[model samples]
Target chain A: MGKYLPKAIVHSDEIDRLLAVEPGWTKKKSGVEKRHYAKSETASDMGAEAVKKALQNADTTLDEIDAIICTSGTMEQPIPCTASLIHKKLAPARPIPAFDINSTCLSFVTGFDLISHAVANGTYKKVVIVASEIASVGLNREQKESYVLFGDAAAACVVETADEETTGILAAKMETYSEGAHLTEIRGGGTKYHPNFHHNEQDFLFDMDGQKVFRMSSKVINPFVDELLQEADLSIKDLKAVVPHQASGMAMRLLQKKLGIPSSQFINVIENYGNTIAASIPLALCDAIESGKIQRGDHVMLLGTSAGLSLGGMIFVY
Target chain B: MGKYLPKAIVHSDEIDRLLAVEPGWTKKKSGVEKRHYAKSETASDMGAEAVKKALQNADTTLDEIDAIICTSGTMEQPIPCTASLIHKKLAPARPIPAFDINSTCLSFVTGFDLISHAVANGTYKKVVIVASEIASVGLNREQKESYVLFGDAAAACVVETADEETTGILAAKMETYSEGAHLTEIRGGGTKYHPNFHHNEQDFLFDMDGQKVFRMSSKVINPFVDELLQEADLSIKDLKAVVPHQASGMAMRLLQKKLGIPSSQFINVIENYGNTIAASIPLALCDAIESGKIQRGDHVMLLGTSAGLSLGGMIFVY
Candidate 1:
């Protein structure tokens, strides 16, 4: 493996929970039915699994990695980084480098940039990136609106250098938006609502202004796609499949419709996966790959948005 | 001022406390005593002051910067992003792109790569980067042992394509260690410890394995610096100064000794700045420049390390 190590995609939905909320709680609007919910475990486990898979998939060992780039929105622990915790699963003597990115959903894209540059610049020979989202853990089951829209899943991508043209990722573009940060934010524990006092509980809930997020989602969807198009020197006509972030089925459909494409032209995982948040983009893209929708030469457009109101886009050929 | 933006460096007394409990607390061998500390305020304010100085030193206006990259380890509010908060302080409208980097202390190096590549490959022309840290809010200030070693500080740099051979940044590198994420970290508040429970207030405090961190720190520092040194084709003898993360006076001195450089050859800011975390690297470099310790054609090595256990080193000549 070059910059990207071996990765394995794992999804969990085995946890049994009561689906009590909003309308159509049982109905999977975007094809998303049940998402993996961690009981006592954390997102790091999912990340760890992916890391393990990536290593096994690539026939490499954890000690071989120069560094591990962890991209996720669901931060599992505070002191020990989820990545570090995951790394702890291995030998402590093999203290490989690692860090986490909080660019919201843009994390993977940012992760790609970090890994790509590291490899490009020769700081690392092999690096691993794991994208895991435990959205189900943060959203209260009581909030059917948000609950039904999320799916918890993790995907691993192993990037390695090869003469194979299709193997190396071509180009990527990742950007962030702080003006719309509050559009989808978990307003707790951060400095904004932090408390030194012991009685101050209730700061860790995932709170969001859904309508605002929808509005922001609607606004950025096209311009970014256009920017990506211009940068890649490609067009809607050239893309074989567009993997927009799996947020709401309505959002994906709207973007697809606005782009004037058949529903088949878009990858729809929400119907079965709900919204995996950051994991949704990669999960859907990889799902498209697994389902044989993608070919070796087809250009794929991956766009995602996160709770930080962050937006990122990356294009690669499978 | 002609080719690069000017910045101010500030250090606090909170550094020793950090080094004291650093994973290898028994080592008690931090090379620097003071780091940097920020007063109770928004990261943007601290960053803004640095930005203002950079602007004044560069003799430019906010409108001149095509984009601003606000880098911070401690943000007042994680939502708006420290950069966006600074953007609100500037003219909100003029196409000035802003965002923050959480690569831990390697942030500036990461920012260096982003902008350098953006300007080199993308459409950005003039870009600025701000390194600001105010980690005190997360500490148990009651524990003077930890609080005294960290201080709040911010530094700014205007990066642009200039026709100068004397003072301009050259090659840069970035890498992360997910394993190192916990080297220095706060143990609570995200998905791991559902901060919604009021009794877990202590989880919000920074919990670090000092000995583990220092050991990891020394381990990663040399290799990282070597990467940059190789990339820049510079030997230790070719460099005029080494501006490292201001973890402590003892740490810096140790690094100097390890690097086989005289104490005078090292740029020391820990005594005044404390451990500004991500801000230390850039802040110290700026201080070296302001003090005239670094001059035209001098090769400077900027190294960063922190909580995510990430380490990055880049060599630049100015």
Candidate 2:
């Protein structure tokens, strides 16, 4: 696992000043103390850095990787999937398949779950899945609920056939309750509300009905986690670590409490990193692994609720 | 296989009139006689229609589908991936895993190839892959080269475990040469040139250097196809049908000639459909299957070069 954050780290104090709020208002409202914000770094640049770190951590080179899959919530450019741009930055010695799998904030979890099967089936010997987000770019400063809740970062993992029989995905599931699709969204920058045809700046910025998203997610998450754990024939107590998407401080707290997991078992990085969109889960997972909250041979669960109003979870032994 | 086109049908004559060009010039330059343009339809709307037709064709209902994957070059919205929106429109009886695999024009090819492995391995029993594009919305009408070269459409296919032993993918490969990534692109509609911060109208439009794309593709396609055939241990003569991305008339003619594939074996629908971005391959494939050009147990190859400057091919026994 690997991670990369841009050099510009903005503290909640900075956001408070920028938004002309009280000193602790930004942190209190968003539960973000400090987070990385990209000034000039591109998503692909951060992603490539993460990939390089991942390769180094795995003690492997790009030559050993069979495929590169980028799971990004927001793209750097609309054409040539973000993976290709990351590939361009990496400049691998040989050509390899590069593509993207997007599921909003749950992109990393979705990519990991799906690609793990491909790896186990011998379709690819080794693959690099990178989740990179420049969430700071699209924030609507007028909407404090979402504007200060996102950060810019990239995280990557090197996945391959498991060397140990027990160290593999035990169960993975994703369900989309599209009824909440409108709860969280960037309505512009696509065909439906294209920039060329529409000039509303607000549409291009990130917009979210935080209350609706919370309400929708609260209703679905419990049962979704139950289904995931049931599929693996395990209980929440069996997990050594639970890496959930750093969606927000309230969501994480509520989810952890609802799941009845101890604070030590639930990974939380939002206070420092904010919500990095698709990079949240993998970034938090990396932190867990690096901090020894999760270790080899330990059972872990990765879970998240994405903008699709989708619930995704994967149980596996690390 | 299934397909959907919007209510509006646009002929080259209309384009000529709009561009103040001589009659027949649009068709002569673009090799596109007429194409469908969306008036009020959305990508997800068309994608749901295609998914419905695909389900009917497969004699299955949404309840039987284990997953939904949307492969589109352009998205309906920037958040909550298009697959989720399609799922919303379909309103399946139950929640299913829905996401997106994007590789620009080769999105369907990539999704089909990758998801085939998942199906064969029993990760999913049945999956629907939909490729929908609203290329007309992003066209730069002032740039006639690409202005009349695109249309809006959607196509989908139902994939599941093959009952016949011979009906399956034999081999598949994709290689990205990102050096050509800049040759074709929609530079805006994403984080790098976001509409909120950047107001250049030209940046949001589809931009392409046809000559550069051709030069890049021509240099890599022959060897790429050779490698694909070698991997499958089959020669060009063995393929009963060749379904290539209806990128453009010139590209199709050049690739077919370079590949030494006979016209009878080549699938061409660009003249009638124009270049439907990611939907081109599946739309053409559906036409081929419906028109009896490709039959059961036939050895067929699906190939395309996408905006990533990526070459992809899959040889399978249909």
Candidate 3:
């Protein structure tokens, strides 16, 4: 596991200066003080940097990786999945399979769901999953309410088949509700609005209804997490940490309270990092591991809600 | 098992009038006579229509699908992963997981590889793999050589866990050479050159070095197909059909001659519809099945070279 954050920090106090509007209101509303922004870096570049760190932490070489699965919410280019470019940077000599799996912000969890199955089935030896986001470049200034909640960051994980003696994923599930797909989206840059056809700057950027996402997520997340634990034959008491997506400070607090997970056991990093889109859960898990909050043989829950009005949760052992 | 193509047809000869290039040059250069273009449809709209046909062919309903994995090279929107919108169109009442997996033109094979693994593991009961492309909208007339080769189309397949008594996938492999990642790309819509940063129409459209891609693909495709058969414990003699990606007329011809596959077994539709990117292989396979060229119990080879300078081959029973 490894994480990377760009150096350009923009505090909520600076939003007014940048957007020429009121500032402190964002922090007061979302609890995000400051967030990192990329300086001349593309999403794939950030992803490649994170992969190098992950390989080092795993004590593995790039060539040992059978596949590179990129789950980035924002891509470096529209063609040739970002994973290919990451593979070029990480292991140019190795002809490994590479592709992109996207479910917006929940992309990493979806990638994990697929990779875990492939690894467990003995179809792949090692797979590197990287979720990178350069949200600063796409943030809509007019939509400061949602813009202030996002930050630029990348996280990567090296997954391999776990032996019988080792603890591995016990249960995993992914579900989506398209009814809320429009709640978070970038309306342009695709076939629907090819630059030749519809050219609107704001349409090319991110938009979200934060309050609606919170209300919608609240309805299903508790049951989603509970069902995961039940399927894994475990209880919340056994969980050392529930590393939920670092979406928003308020959302995380509400989720933790609704699920009855202790603040000590709930991994939260939105204050310092903001919502790093797909990279959120992995980055939070890295923080938990480095801080010694989660130890080997401890049960941990990987959970999140995504743009597709999606809910996914996985119970696994560290 | 089913497919759908748009009604609007734009012929190659018409390209000269539309772009004011030259008459009969597109066909003489790329062997493309005509192609389809979506009139008022988005990529997801085309994909949902295809999914409906696939469901009917499979004698299944939209709600029966456990997952919708869209592998479209071109998307309807920049966010929400295209599949979610397609799900909304196809199964609004069902809350199934939907996402997109992209490897450019080879996206379908990649989706199939993942879906097969998940189905085999019983992680998903019924998954709909859709490869939809609206390349006509992205074609850059300034780059006529590559532009003339693209067409609009969509194809889909309904896959479930195969019973032990039924024949399913024998072997599958997907490999990429990111060294050629820049060979074929749409550079603008994403973070590297977001519409907000670089708003040039050409920057948002397709770019390609056809000769270089041909040289690069020629190096690996033969072995890619051969190894797939070898892993499946079969040979070219045992193959009933070879459905290659409908990239171009000359490229397909050269590939067939090199592989020693008879024209009787080789499937080609580039003349009528041009290259449809990710939709090519499945569309060709669907044609083969409908035409009775590939029958039940027959061993068919699905092979393609994608924009990532990628090569993928899947030998399975029809």
Interface RMSD of each: 3.8, 1.2, 1.0
Best by DockQ: 3
- Residue range B52-72, candidate 2, lDDT tens digits: 998998899888899899999
Question: What is the TM-score of each candidate's chain B when compared with the real chain B?
Answer: 0.84, 0.98, 0.97
DockQ of 1: 0.33
Candidate 1, residues B109-141: lDDT per residue as tens digits? Answer: 666765565564434667778876666667774
Provide the TM-score of chain A alone for each candidate, in the order shown: 0.84, 0.98, 0.96
Candidate 1's interface RMSD, please?
A: 3.8
Query: lDDT per residue, candidate 2, A144-252, as tens digits?
Result: 8788899999999999987769698989989988888888888888889988778888988888998888887788788888888999999998999999889888888
lDDT of 3 by residue, B21-130 (tens): 78888887777888888887778888998988888988998767899999988788888899988988887667789999999998999889887888888888889999
Lowest lDDT sum, 10 consecutive residues, model 1 chain B, at: B1-10
Q: Alpha-carbon error at B284 in model 2, in Å? A: 0.3
Judge candidate 3 at residue B123 and give its lDDT: 83
Question: Which of the predicted structures, 1 or 3, would earn the higher TM-score when compared with the native?
Answer: 3
